[model samples]
Target: MKVLISGASVAGPVLAHWLHRYGFEPTIVERTPELRHGLGGHAVDLFSSAAEVTRWMGCWDAIDAARTRIDSMTMERFGRRPVEVDLSRMYAGISSSHVEILRGELTRILYDASRDTAEYIFGDSIASLSDDGSGVDVTFDSGTQRRFDLVIGADGLHSNVRRLAFGPEEPLRRWLGGYLAVFSMPDIFDVGNHTLAHLSVDKLVGIYGVHQTGQTRSGFLFRTPHELRYDYRDKDEQKALLVKEFSNYGWRVPQLLEHLESAEDFYFDSIAQITLDTWSKGRIGLVGDAGYCPGPAVGGGTSLAVMTAYVLARELAAARSDLASGLKSYERIIRPLVDQSRRIGPKLMGTIIPGSPLALRLMPFAAATLAKLPTAMQRFIWSQNAVGKTLSSVNLVQPQVSQSVA
Candidate 1:
């Protein structure tokens, strides 16, 4: 069978890899002109199940070696002493196998693994998708037309495939009452393999080192009473908005803002989740953040994306010629995980970005205390939370390919 996948970042490449392995031809269409493979981009985590998928792909060792070796974090409040938390220890408590790596690096690794097996088309996108029950006829923005047995959207939030296959994103999107901005800058504080964060009520400013580039990334996450209106594509407008919001805010923010205008890779977006009743319509289906994004930053989106793509591929292969049944089975299998994942973002937002002064004080204290706990006790405590429960519940075993495929 021939399949076409959208967005080459995380899920697309992963789905491509597995589809090819399962006796299917996969073609990837990425909007970007070239592969984004470098030290740039925000840090993302891969928990046990996601790690296991990579291990099965034979990419685990490479990903582990490329991990961001940030082991500790220092939380600061205005006029208060810094509270230190062992991030490595905390991560260990959360999942037995976990790695934090730059999103670009992970994409590069996944892309490299799948590039040899799949056909990749960069600098183009699906302009329209016509699923005729038998196949999906896709028209690209570059004016190329092709037909595939199935089409999948592995794109991230604000996916082009989702917009084309489903409807507009506004009705399906649930704003989580927060926003996030990230940009790269010189390592002025000389922070090496550590994260420094300044927390205030309803707001957080963080700077973490990128050992591979010898630079640092500044991230600002803040809560708003109502959604802000702005063009998602305008970087200048977003930068100005960020400055206005944090104008009166103190604590090294001024220094950070100085480099904002010149930062070419600045990213700004709302922390929102996609609520779709189903991920498929006939031969067209959606995977990863395209279909169901719990929320960005706060939610374990990376792991969710990785695991769902893997499941989608497995289900499709199992269904063989009946691809429609495969899509339905994929949705049914992942619905529980997706539902459980949606609950994580809001609870984490309340905890990470405090709503009150009391919470601001208590958040750091709680993190420090958790980090100080013994590994066993920490695991016990974490196992009771939403994240732990979600991670532990994911069970994926490789099923033998039926002789029918060959």
Candidate 2:
């Protein structure tokens, strides 16, 4: 069977890998000109199950070697003293014990491993999808057309394929009442050797050491109750909005915005979650953030993508190419994980960022009480991080196909 995937990032490449292993041809289409560039050394943790998937895929070593090594972190409120949280205590309730690696490194390694197996068409997206229930006829923005047995939307929050296959994202999107913008800056502070300094009041800014490179990456998170005025496609306008919101703020933010001027990889978007009633319809299915992104705050996106692709391909192969039954089975088991990941966003945001003055006043007390909190209370607070909750592959019960199509 021939499969066409909409995204080339986390989930799409993963689906391609599994599809290949299952003996089905998968073709991936990406909107980006190439595998993305200029990302911060953000770490990704996979619950043991997701880890096993990567181990089987054989990119785990490269990811581990390229990980960002941060010695420690300090959280401070402006005009107040900084407090250090215990590392083990800080990571206490988290899911993956395998440690965190940058998102870019994970994607790069996955892309390389799958390149020989899957055909990737870069710098374009599907112009239209003409599905006749028998198969999908896809037209590319570059004016090419093709047909495939299945089409999967692994695109992120703002998924074009989701709209084409399912419906508009409006009914499915839930805004978490915040905006996050991240961009690269030259190592102006000469931050050396470790990822350090986390500051949060109602917002957060951090400088992290990127692997062995002398440069550091800065994260700027801005909180807003109302939507801001800016075009997502207009980089200039987006930069202006970022500048306006953060110009008066301190702690090396001004310098970070300086790099925002010329940085081609600057990303500005609302901290939003995508929740859909159904992940699959007909021969088309939604995976990863397109189907269920609990937002970046949950820190389980990469893991979810890996698991999603694995389950999807497994269901497909097990169903003997009966797309409908397989998609339903895939959605039934995956939704519970998606629901858990979804609930994580607002809970983490409520604690992580004190959105109101009253909440802000309560944070330090909460922090101080954190050490004193009973094991039960501590567990409750840490539960929001979405750790140790990833659904693994072998756990999925594959349905047998009475009728073989593949």
Candidate 3:
């Protein structure tokens, strides 16, 4: 069987790895000119089953070596004393089985692991896909054409494949009334190794030193009742918009803006989730953020991407010669976790972005108090947070495989 996968970031490469393992010939078409690397992305976490899947792929050790290793995080208000929270203690309430790494680093590791196993075509994308009851005829942006038995849309939030296969994305997109921008900057704030964050009503700015990378990761997330005007591909316009939104704010805003002007890897997007009634129609299917993205920065979307790829591959292996059944079973096994992730994002808004002056004043105190509490009490307190519980509940069953991919 021949499979064509789109967007070679996290999910696309992972799906390629498993498709090859299941005796299927897989080819990946990535829009980016090359494998994306360096400080292009922010810190992301893999929880429970996601981490286990990496171990099963034999890349956990490489992933762990590239972790952010952030030991503490300090919160500061405009006129108040900064309160430091121990990050290690905070993560304990969550499962011990977690891997926190830079998104780019993880992507590079996955690419290296699977580069030789699959045929990868960079600087291209699927321009059109036609399914005629037997296979998908794919047309590439570079003007090449091919036919495959199946096509998977592992592309991200604004997936081109989703637009072509499903329809327009406006109705399926649910905006969460916020925007997030991340970029790489020098440690101009002089933060040695700890993460420093400043919060105001309806806005938050943070900077954290990435351990061995010699660079810092900074982000700006703010609430906006309505979507702003800008093109997703225009970097200068996006930077100008960010400056316009955060120029009057206090505490390192000026310096952060100064770096933003020249940062090569600036990423800006609305905080939105994608919900669909079904992930597949005919020979086309969607995975990860393409099908059910649970907002960015708030939910564990990375973990969902990793685990869903594994689950989808397993179901396909189980339902050999029955692609529709495999897609249905894949959706069945993954929906509960996707639903829980979406629900948890809204619940965290109050904690993530303070709504009032009083909320900002109390935020550091609450975090400090919780960080200093007894282990058992901390666990009980975190039990109230829906994100942690939902992350722990993801359990993917491994299928029995007698033969390995040659």
| Predicted structure with the largest lDDT when compared to the true one | 1
Q: Which 10-residue span in candidate 3 carries the lowest summed lDDT?
A: 397-406
- TM-score of each model, paired residue for residue: 0.98, 0.89, 0.96
Report the backbone clash tally of model 3: 0
Q: lDDT per prediction? A: 0.92, 0.73, 0.85
Q: Residue-wise lDDT of candidate 1 within 90-180, one digit each (tens)?
A: 9988888999999889999999999999999999988998888899888999999999999999888998888987889999999999999
lDDT of 2 by residue, 203-281 (tens): 7777766655576777766678686766667878888988888788877777777787887567777778887889887
Q: Could you give the candidate ranking by lDDT, starting with the highest?
A: 1, 3, 2
Each candidate's clash count = 0, 3, 0
Give per-model CA RMSD. Answer: 1.2, 3.5, 1.8
Candidate 3 clashing pairs, residues 3+ apart or interchain: none
Better of 1 and 3 by TM-score: 1
Off by over 4 Å in 3: 374-377, 380-384, 402-406
Question: Which one wins on TM-score?
Answer: 1
